[model samples]
Target: MKKKTFVLVVIALVSVGFSAMGQRVDRTNFKAGIHGGVPFGDISDHSNFELGLDVGYHIALSELIDTGLTTGFMNAFINNDSVDAGPVTVEGDFPNIQYVPVAAVFRLYPTYDFKLGADVGYAVGINDGNTGGGYLRPIIGVNVSGNTELNISYVKVSDDYDFSMAALGILFLF
Candidate 1:
């Protein structure tokens, strides 16, 4: 019927409009960001906050999914080893811990404005007696603009201990 054809045409037009808007097309996109936060568990005893810069390249697999590779520099700032608790005092040395994470990222966009992803790979140790191990980060983000996003992630990396941190970051995509 003519009504059915008109409805189909309208639906097709709307789909095309969404594609033109910031929807993921089958292409590659790159992003860069800086993230910082506090370390937790065993690593917290030695470091305060960790700061990092990262870059990623993602290939859109569909309108709602992207897969990519990400790499970054993460540095955990060392804390003073002297512990002065009331009359008890102790002193030692704790150096900054540094790592480079190379990860594969898989992101799923639930809507145009929200996303969730996981990054998994190996972290290479750079300094401070850190012999690196696995790296895993799970993240959630909101797209605030056409080319910008805000995200939070829990990062876990292992060396002699689990060097884990929770981080917040803003990313610019291109």
Candidate 2:
């Protein structure tokens, strides 16, 4: 069921993306891109890094203002090699987690092929092989081109889990 929902969401997004690009191909100057980067931070008291990839699409609403969507997936893993692993580390389950974030972005100054933006959204995570709780994230980023960007963000998770992360990445546009 969840897999089906995820697939449907991807398909719908792709359809909308194609139609949107077709509509903007002549007068709107639309730009769609993807990015990949490493996530640096601690989640749920586990000090592990995450690897992630994201996609975004933008249409010039004006010379300096544009609205778009950003979607991403990340995998986080924690290593427990010590005999005295933390209390949170238990048997029969591991600490590998996955997160998917979908957001709406408002961008400024994308014409120089470099841009800065703010993002507001929620992230859904799967933990220990089960769907976990959600989070709220506030993000800021710089796009050096349609294909490259760097971002920093703060994510707030339930029950006092929180952290900040920085990502350096490249995006491809078509």
Q: Rate the local accuracy (lDDT) of all candidates.
A: 0.81, 0.53
99-126: candidate 2 lDDT, tens digit per residue: 7766555667745655666644546665
Candidate 2 stretches greater than 4 Å from native: 1-44, 81-92, 110-113, 128-147, 150-160
TM-score of 2: 0.60
Q: After superposition, how far is residue 8 of candidate 2 from its true place, in Å?
A: 22
Which candidate gets the maximum lDDT versus the true structure?
Answer: 1
Q: What lDDT score is found at residue 120 in candidate 1?
A: 73
- Global lDDT of model 1: 0.81
Among these predictions, the greatest TM-score belongs to 1
Candidate 1 has what TM-score?
0.78
lDDT of 1 by residue, 1-174 (tens): 643564465345334433543445557788999999899988787688899998987778787887767889999997877755459877877567889987777789999899999877778888866778777899999999999999999998855677899999999998
